[model samples]
Target: MRMALFSLVATVMALGASPAIAQEREQVKLVFEHALPNVEGKRMDAVLVSYPPGSKSLPHRHAASAFIYAYVLSGAIRSQVGNDPTQVYHAGEGFYETPGAHHRISENASDTEPASLLAVFVVDSKDGALTIPDKDATPK
Candidate 1:
């Protein structure tokens, strides 16, 4: 995770990347709440992801050993992980993502509504590149 932080800092330091970063900052809000070492020598990380109306995420994948559980907190979220059918989840609903599964779709279900979800990841403590964006994956 330190490497991910450093990479983000380095990206912001690059003048050419700052503009893109600013735009991303305006689109999503990610709150890293905690990180704890699990008994099995892995790590558990928790984050709250918030999206504004009409917001969607670019295709990405977590680490090879990262398993994720996401629970909707408000509004509605439409998501497709791996080869699963795209589905809409409302508040109090949830879904799970297996390790390395592609996050194919993640967006607010309504164009006029916002959405939020709590995501918890169980992964190796040493995994630094937690999220890997798929450059070739086009947005739908």
Candidate 2:
């Protein structure tokens, strides 16, 4: 009888541990981080983004939201902010977006390598959709 009880306890423990293991695997792979200011007595949503090399996003902006900060991880990326010259960011480097500024253009600098980024956006809620303001603009 004692042996059967011990086996049941062991099985229960194994089942309980399975979910913890799966949760660990779901951890965010952060590449960038930023937060916006309070508007209308509310804080905007923070933004985070991750990408591999050779990845490029369409020209876009966050309406009623703004980028608080941007960070690069793992590899290098290039960003063009408005008419400013394009800048290259290596691992562990980043920049901030001005309020209402056009969402900058981003692209992987290395053709065969991978890169990542984390961007924090200040929106109405902690979990809000990121608005892409201008999708038609060409990448410079």
Top TM-score: which candidate number? 1
TM-score of candidate 1 on Cα atoms, chains taken together: 0.73
TM-score of each: 0.73, 0.60
lDDT of 2 by residue, 36-59 (tens): 243453453333343444566666
Poorly placed runs, candidate 2 (over 4 Å): 1-40, 126-128, 137-140
Residue 53 displacement (Å), model 1: 0.4
| Per-residue alpha-carbon lDDT of candidate 1 for residues 75-130, written as tens digits (9 for 90 to 100) | 89899998899999998788999987999888778667666676768788778876
Name the weakest run of 10 consecutive residues (lDDT summed) in model 2. Answer: 17-26
lDDT for 128 (candidate 2):
46
Per-candidate local distance difference test: 0.68, 0.53
Question: Clash totals for all models, in order?
Answer: 0, 15
Could you tell me how far off, in angstroms, the CA of residue 24 lies in candidate 2 after the best superposition? 28
